[model samples]
Target: MALPKEYVNQMRELLGEEAEDFLASYAEPKKTAIRLNGLKIESTGFGEKEAVDKPSAGQSFVAGRDPVPWAAGAYYTDKTERPGKHPYYYAGLYYIQEPSAMLPAELLDPQPGQRVLDLCAAPGGKSTQLAAKLRGTGLLVTNDLATERTKALAKNIERAGIGCAVVTNESPAKLAAAFGATFDRVLVDAPCSGEGMFRKDEDMVRQWDADAPARYAAMQDEIMLEAAKMVAPGGRLAYSTCTFSPVENEGTIARFLAAHPDFEIVATESPAAWGFAPGRPEWLTPEEAAALGPDRTARLADTIRLWPHRVRGEGHFAALLERAAPSGMAVSGASPESEPAGAAAAESRKAGGKTGGASFKDPKPGKRTTAVRRGAEAAGRGRSKGFDDRTGGESDTIARYEAFLRESLPGWKPPGTIRIKGDHVYAVSEPAGSMQGLRLVREGWLLGLSTRHRFEPSQALAMGLKPHQAALSLQLAGESEDAIRYLKGETLQPEPAKVTGLNGEPADKRGWTLVCLDGCPLGWGRWDGATLKNELLPGWRQV
Candidate 1:
C-alpha cells in the first residue's frame, strides 16, 4: 500500500527522520491483542502461563515471548493461530481485541456504581471492557444502530458475564429522549471512516478517499451533541475514533467545543504520568484558537493523540470533556424519572414473563397493555384451540390458567418481572425462583428472584441446610477418580454419576446441588436422586 501525499507530509511533520520507515511499516499494521476479560485473569499471570498453556486456543504463542505493551494483559499474535476458538474464549477468560481499540474504555475509567453509556456500541469490544470496569454493578446502556449487530453485541455482553447492562437498538435521538442527562459518563466511540483499520482490513483502503473523514465527522458531531445532552452536569464524555484525519480527530472536537460552551476540554494525564500533548490550535476554531495562547495551550497538554508511529498500538484519538453545570439544573446525582407508560409496558413485555394485560395503576399513566392469546394452542392444524372459538374458549383457558396459578402460587404474580428479548429475558428475578422454575417458555427461559433484590444471586441460601446438600459431593459409580478431578477444576469426559448425601446416604432427592472446591462454591449441578448433572460456573466452566 502506498501512502497518500497528505499522509506522507503529515508523517514528516509528526516524525521527521523516521517518517519514511513509519510509512513502510504502515503497509501492514502489526497485530495487537488483549486478553479477553482482565477481571478474571491478570495480564502478567496469563502471559506467564501462555507459553506452556499456549493460550491462543492452540494458536502457538511463539514458545518464549513477552507481553504486548499497548494494553495491560495484551500480546501480539503472528496471525498463525485462531485465538477466537480457544477454550478460554468459551470460558470468557479473555477477549481477543485490538490494542488501540482498548484505549477509549481505559480513558473513560468507568467505575462501579456509575451510570455509563456506549453510544455506538456494536459487536461490543469497548462495551465489554466497560462492563468489566463496572465490576458487575450499576447500569450500562449500550446502543447500536444495526439490529443484527446489536444481537451479537448482547451475546458478547452475556458471555462476558455482564449483569447490569441494557442493550438497545435505536438512534441517538431516541436514546436521548429515553435517557436525558442521565449518565455519569458517556462514550461516543462514534462510527467513522476506517483509516486506522485500513492496514488490517485492506478493503477499507480500497474504499477510502479524502472526503470520507469529513462525511464521518458530520455524523460524529451529531453523536457528540447527543452525548453531551445525556451526560450529567459535571460528568465526563470521551470521544474517540480510529482514523488519523484531522477532520475526524481534533477538528471534530474543536467544532463541538465551539458549539457547546457549557462543555470544557478537560486535560487528562496518562496512567503512568507520562503526560499528553494538547490539541493543536491550528485545528481549532478561530475563537478557540485565540482563547489559548502558546502558554495556556501548554497548560492543556494532557489531551491524548496516539499515532501508530509513536504508540505501540493503532492510530487513534481520544479527548475527555467535562460537562459544565447548566444554570438551575440539579447536579444531585438523581436518575431520570421512569420511562413513559406505554413504553414502560412495552419494555416490560420485552423483558419477558406474562403481562396481565392490565396497565400499572400509577397516576403518571406510563404503562399500556395489549392482549394476545393466553394458553397453549391446538396441535395438528398448527392452531390453538381458541382459534376456532375465540371468545369463550380462550377466556375459559385464561380463567383456568389464572385459577391454577392462584392456587399453586398464592402470593406470586405471573413471572412478569422479567423482560424477554429473543431467546432470553432480562429478569428481575432468577428464572429458577419462578413458579415454573426452570421450565422453558416461548421466551426461552424463565428466571426468578425476590422482587426487592431484582435478580441478584443469593447463593442458594436455602441449599445451605437442605438434607441433600451433602449429595453435591457424591461420586459417579464408575468414575470416582474423574469426579475427584472434576471437583479440582480439571477437564473430564462426560459420564453418569450416582448421587448420595454427604453422609453417604440417599433419599428421594431431585434438584440442583452446589458443588464446592474446598468449601468454595465452584458452581451448580443437578441431581435426579441418582445421577448428578453439572451447570458450568459463570466463570470457571470452560475447562
Candidate 2:
C-alpha cells in the first residue's frame, strides 16, 4: 500500500518514533468479531445461565477464544468462519461488528429504563449495543440524517428484536429542539475522514485528502453542540470517531469544553487495561491550544485513543463528557409536560398496559391528533391490501389487536405506548405524539399489520418473543434441514407431534407459532395439523 505523503508526515509528527510500527501494522489482517444478542438468548434462557461468557450455540465456532476484553458477549472470529450464513444469524442471535467500534456504546453505559439517543446512528451497530444495554426497558431514538441510510438502520433494529427503539431520519438540530434536555445518555459517533478504516476498506484510503481533518472537525463540533442539547442535566454524552486526526478528536472535545462550562471530561476506567492511550493535547496547534486555554486543553488527556499498532483493531478515538446539574435537578427523563406541543395531554391519555395491550383512547382534537392522523394517512394502504378505513376509531383497532394477543401470546404483557397508524401497529416506548413531526422510519416496535378483522404479527414481533411467550412454538436445531428451509421461506410438513404448546406439551398445531432455533425465537409461522406455512419477512429470507 502506498501511503499518502501528507498523511505520513502528519503521523510522523503525531507518533514520533512509533510511526514505523503504526505504518507496519496496516499490513496485518483486519480483525473479525460478533456480539451475542442478549435480547434474544437471555430472554429465553437459551444456552446457559450466563450467555455472555459462554454462548452454547456458537461455542464450537468461538470457543477457547478470549472474548473482546472491553465488551461482554463479543468474541473474535477468523475471517473464514462465515457466521453470517448460519441459521442463528437469521434468528438474530448476534451482530457482526468490528472490535474497536464497540467501545463507544460501552463507555456511554446506558442503563435499563433510561432514555438514550444515537445521533448519527445508521447501519446501527452502536445503536443496537445501546438497545441491548437498555434491555427493552427504555426509549432509544436512533437517527441518521441520511434518508436512504435509515433503511438499514431500521432493518438492523428490527432484526435484533429490539422493541423499544424509535428509528428516525432527521437532522441533529431538529431532534435537539424536539427533545430538549431529555435523554439520560446520548452518543455522537461522528463521521470523519475514514483514516482508521483505510486498512479494512481501500475506498477510504482512495477518498482521503490532506484537508479532510479540519473539514470534518467543523462538522463534528456542530454535531456535538446539538447532541449536548438533548442530554438531560447531569446526564452523560459519549463522542466517538474512527479517525486518528487530532483536530477531530482532542481538538473537538477541547472546543466543546471551552464553550460549555457545565460539562467536563470524566476519566474512564484504566486506559492501560484496554490497550488504549491518553488523548494527545500536544498534537494540537499552539494557536488552537491557546484559544482553548490551558485548563481546558489539559483536560483533553482524559479522552482515549485506540491506535491500530497498540490494539488488535483499527484506529479509534473516544471521550466521555458529563453535564453538571443544579441542586435537585438531575432527573433521568423529561416529564410529559416538558415535551413539545401538547404532548403532555397525549401522554396522559396514551398510558397503556403491559405489552402495550390496553384499550386505545384517542387524544383530544388539536395538534397531537392532527399529527396522528397525518402519520396514519402517510402510512395508509389501499383496501386491496385487506385494510379498511373504518370509522370505528382506535378502540376497535385495539380490540382486534387484543384478540390476537389473547390467542397467540396468551398472558404476555410488554410495556410501551401502543400506536395504531393506518394498517400498521406499533408499541412506542416514548410518550405518544412526542415525536410527531420528525421523519420517522419506525415509530417503535412494529407489532404487525391490522387487516380488516385480522391482526397479522410481524417478523419483528417474533424476534423479540421468547419460546414461552407464545402459546405455540416450533423449536429446531441449528444444523437441522427444517431450520434452513424455514429461513429460506419454504413451507414445511413437520410432524404434528413436533409442535409444542407454551408448556412444551403437544399443542393444537392449528394457529400462529413462534419459530425458534435452539430455543431462540426466529420469526412467526402459522401451523396447521398437516403443514406449517412460513411467515418470515421476504426481505429477510435466506437466499
Candidate 3:
C-alpha cells in the first residue's frame, strides 16, 4: 500500500523529525480491539438478571486477555481470532473497535442520569460506549445528518441493548433548534478527510487530496457551532476527528473558540497515558484561519493527538470543551435542592455554578417544548404521521403491548413513557415532548411492534433481555458448533431428554424462544413442539 505523495509531503512537513517513524508504522499490522458492554457489568442493571463480567463467573461474554489502558472493559483482542464471527457478537457482549477510535467517548465521559448527545453517531461504536457510560440512567440522543446511515447506528445500539438513547436522523441545525442547551455533554466526532483510515483501508489513501481537508473543515465549522448550542451552559462538547489535518483539528477548534469565547477548551483525562501526543497549534497558520489569535494556539494545545508513530493504534484528534454558563444536573421533578451526580454535576460543583440557574433545567417527560429542550427530557416525543399518541396506536396498542411486556418479561416495568407510532412501539428513556418536526428514526429503545392481536418483540428487545426473562431459553457454549448454526439461523434439535418445558418441567408448549450463547441472547426463535424454529433476522445470518 503506497501513501499518497502530496499527503506524504504534507505529513513530512507536519511531523518534522518524526516523519520516517510515522510512515514506517503503517508497514506494521493494524491492531484489533473490542469493548465489552459495561452495562453488562455485575452491578449495572439493564435487565432484571445481572450479566456477569467474566464467563468463569457466570453466563456472560469473556473479557479480552489484555486491557486497553484508556478504556475500562475494553481490550486488545487477539489478532489471530475472528472476534466478529464469535457467537457473543450476536449477544451484544462487545463491540469491535479501532483502539484509538475509543478515545473520544472516554474523553467525553458521559455519566449516569445526564442528558447527552452524539452529534454524528453512525455505525454507533462511540455511541455504544457513551451508552455504557450512561449506565441506562440518563438520556442519550444519538443523531446523524445522513438519514440512511442511522439504520446502522440504530442496529448497533440495539445489539448492545442500549435503552437510554434516542436515535435521530436530523441535521445539526434542526437538532439545535429543537434541543438548545439541553445536553449535558455533546460529542461531535466530526466527519473528516479519512487520512487516519489509510492504515486500515488503503482505499482512503487512493482518495486523499489536498483540497478535501479544507472542504471537511468548513463542514465541521458549521456542525460544531450548532453542536455547541445543544450543550447546556455548564455542559461540555467533545470534538474529534480521525484525520491529522490541522485545518480539521486545531484550525477548526481555534476558529470556534474565536467565535464563542464563552466556550473554552478544557483538559480531558491525560492522553499521555496511552502514548497520545498533544495537538500542534503551530500547525494552524494565519492564512488558514483569519480569526485565530495568539491565545488560540496555547488553548488548542490542550487538544489530544493520537499519531500512528506515537501510539499502538490508528491516528486521531480530540478537544474537550465546556460552556461558561451555569446549568442544572438534577432530573426534572427532582427538588430544587436535589443534587446532581456524574461528571457534569461534578464539574458544575467545581466551578461553583448553580444547576438550573441559567435557562437550562431538567426536561419534563411527554410534554411539548418550543423554547428549549430540557436536559432531562427523554427522546421520542415527536408525533409521527401514522401513529396516534393518544390511543398509543390505532386500537389499544399500548394496552396490548404493556400486557405483552408483563407476560413476556415478568417483573418488567416501563422505564419511562411507552409510545407507539404506526406499527412501531418505542420504550422511551426520557419524556419525549413534542418532536413533531424532527426526523427521529428511533427514540429510546425500539421495544418492538404492535399488531392487531398481539405484540411482537423486536430483535433489539430480545437482545436486551436477561436469559431467564424469556419463556424459553437455550444457553449454548460459545464454541459450540450449534452456536455457529444458531447464528446462521439454523434450527437446533436437542436430545428429547434435554427438551423440557419453559418452566423446567415436562416437554411441550412455547411461542417465542430466546437463543443464547452463555446466557446472552443471540436472537429469537419459536418452539413448535418438535423443533426450535430460528427467527434470527435474515441480515444477521452468519455468512
Candidate 4:
C-alpha cells in the first residue's frame, strides 16, 4: 500500500506529524459492513434490552451494541460469519455496503414527497437510501449507463421497498431529454478511478496511475453537466466518488461550478463534530487549499472525505451543490417525455383507448364473479364512473373500459369479456376469482392496500423470510409459524397467511393485509383463497 508522492506531500503539508502515521496504516482495504433497513424492521428497537427480553424474541447482533450515533445503526465487525446466510439478510432487512459510502445520502437529506434523481445509480446503494429517505412518496428516477447493471440496480431498489420510482438504462443525454429540470434533488455518485476503493479491492491499486484521476475527472464533468440540467431551481445535488484524487474531487466540482455559474458550493460541518475524523485531501491548487485556512488544510475542507486510516471506514468523498434560482427565466412545469414508440402505444392502449379489437379480451367465463365484483367495487370507489358507456360496442366500449381499468388497476390484466367504447376500455373479470388478491408491485415490494386502499407495512415484503416458519421464529400454539416468522423479519415459506387488520381489526377475511410486529409496521401480504401469499416489500427485500 504505497501512497503517491504527491498525496504524501499534500498530507505532510496538511497534517505535519500525523501524515506519515496515517499513510502507513492502510495495509489493506477494510472489509464491508451490513446495515439493517430500518424501514422493514425497527433498527432502533433491535438491540434494546426490552426487545431482547421478550420470551419469544431472538437476539439481534445490532441489539445492545453501542453504534456510532452519527452513523446510526452502523458498526464494524469481523467478517468471519457469512452475512448472506443471516435470516435478517434474507428478509432484506439490511444491505451490505461500504461504511464510508453512506455519507452522501445523509448529507443530501432527502425527504418524503420530493422528486429525486440518482444520475449514475447502479447496484443502487445510495439510490435505495434516498428512496428510504423519501419514504415511498413522490418519484425517484434512478439511471445507469450500463443496461446489465441497470437491471441489478432496479432489483436492489425493489428489494429496498421503494415505490414510485422509475429505473432507466440510458445515457445522461437521454435522461436529460426525458426528465429535464424536474427533480427536487439529484445525486451524482459518479463513476471514478477506484483510488479510494484500493483498500477494498487491491486490483484497483495495480491499475491506478497519475493519469487515471484526470481521465475520470473528464467523465465526471460531463455527468455533472447532465446532472445540472435535471436539477430543478433551488434544488440540491450531491457529487461523490470513491477515489482519492483531487482531480476527481474538488477539481471536478470546481470545473462544474465554473461552467454552471448558477450553482454554488455549500459548506458542510466536519464529520469529526459528529464523532468521525476529517477525511483525506485530494491534491488541490495552492490557492484553493489556502482558502480552507489554518484550522483545516484538506483541499476539500468544505466537502467531506472519509479515510479508512483515520475514520475506521472506507475512503470516500462528497460535496453538496445547490442550484440557484433561474435568472431571467420563467419557471414552468416540466413533464417527462412519453415512453419509446411501441411501448407508448401499448401503454396508451392499456390506458383504455381503442387501438383495435385485438387488444381487448374477456377473461374466461364462469370462473367466479365474487372476486371480479370485489376488484370492481374497489376500483369504482377509488375513481369516478362517468367514463362508462351504455352501448356495448366491443372495440369502442372496451377501449374506454380499458382506460378506466388502467387507472383503477395499475397492473390489472384486462379480461377478454370487456368491451371498448369510443375512448375508453371497459373490462370485467369474467371469472372474477382470477383477479382476486392482485398485489401491487412497485420497486420489488408487494403493496398491501388497506380497506381504505392505503398501503400498509408487512414483513412478507422482505426476501430473507424462511422457507418455513420453523427456521425463523418460535411458533405459537395453533397459529401458523410462517405468518409469525414473516412479521418477525425471519425466513419463512413462500406461503403467507391472509389476515385482516387495517385499523387493527381481527385477522380474518382478506384481500391484502399489512403485517406488523409489536404494533410496528413491516410490509404487506396478499391472501388468495385459503392461503396468504408473500409480496416482498420494495426496499425491504434487498437484504
**TM-score of every model versus the real structure:** 0.63, 0.87, 0.82, 0.62
| Total residue pair clashes for candidate 4 | 62
Put down candidate 2 lDDT per residue, 132-168, tens digits, no spaces. Answer: 6655565788899998898888888878878777788
Task: Name the candidate that leads on lDDT.
Answer: 2
* Best candidate according to TM-score: 2
Per-residue lDDT for 217 in model 4?
A: 90
Which runs in model 2 stand beyond 4 Å of their true positions? 43-55, 271-273, 328-396
Q: After superposition, how far is residue 93 of candidate 2 from its true place, in Å?
A: 1.1
Give the lowest summed-lDDT range of ten residues in model 3.
353-362
The local distance difference test score of each candidate is: 0.51, 0.74, 0.70, 0.52
Q: What TM-score does prediction 3 earn?
A: 0.82
**Clash count, one per candidate:** 25, 2, 8, 62
lDDT per residue, candidate 4, 1-543, as tens digits? 765676567557766787666676577547566654534433223323333245223234553433333333454456575665554444355677787787787667654556677878888888766665544344666778877787667667645555445566678876776667767778999999877777777787677776777799999999988889988776778999997677788777766765776776666555364434443444556664555443434324567776666665667888877777656644322212212322322332231211110121112211100000111100100111232323444444434333433432235442223322232332221220121232211222222222222223223222212212111211222124553456444543342332433322333344443343332333444544354455443334333
Give the 10-residue window scoring lowest on summed lDDT in candidate 4: 368-377
Candidate 2 TM-score over all chains jointly: 0.87
lDDT of 4 at 25: 57
Candidate 1 — worst ten consecutive residues by lDDT sum? 375-384
Q: After superposition, how far is residue 354 of candidate 2 from its true place, in Å?
A: 35
What are the per-residue Cα lDDT tens digits for candidate 3 across 238-345?
A: 899999999999999988988897887775445465587888888877754557667656778778898888777888998888777633333332222223324333
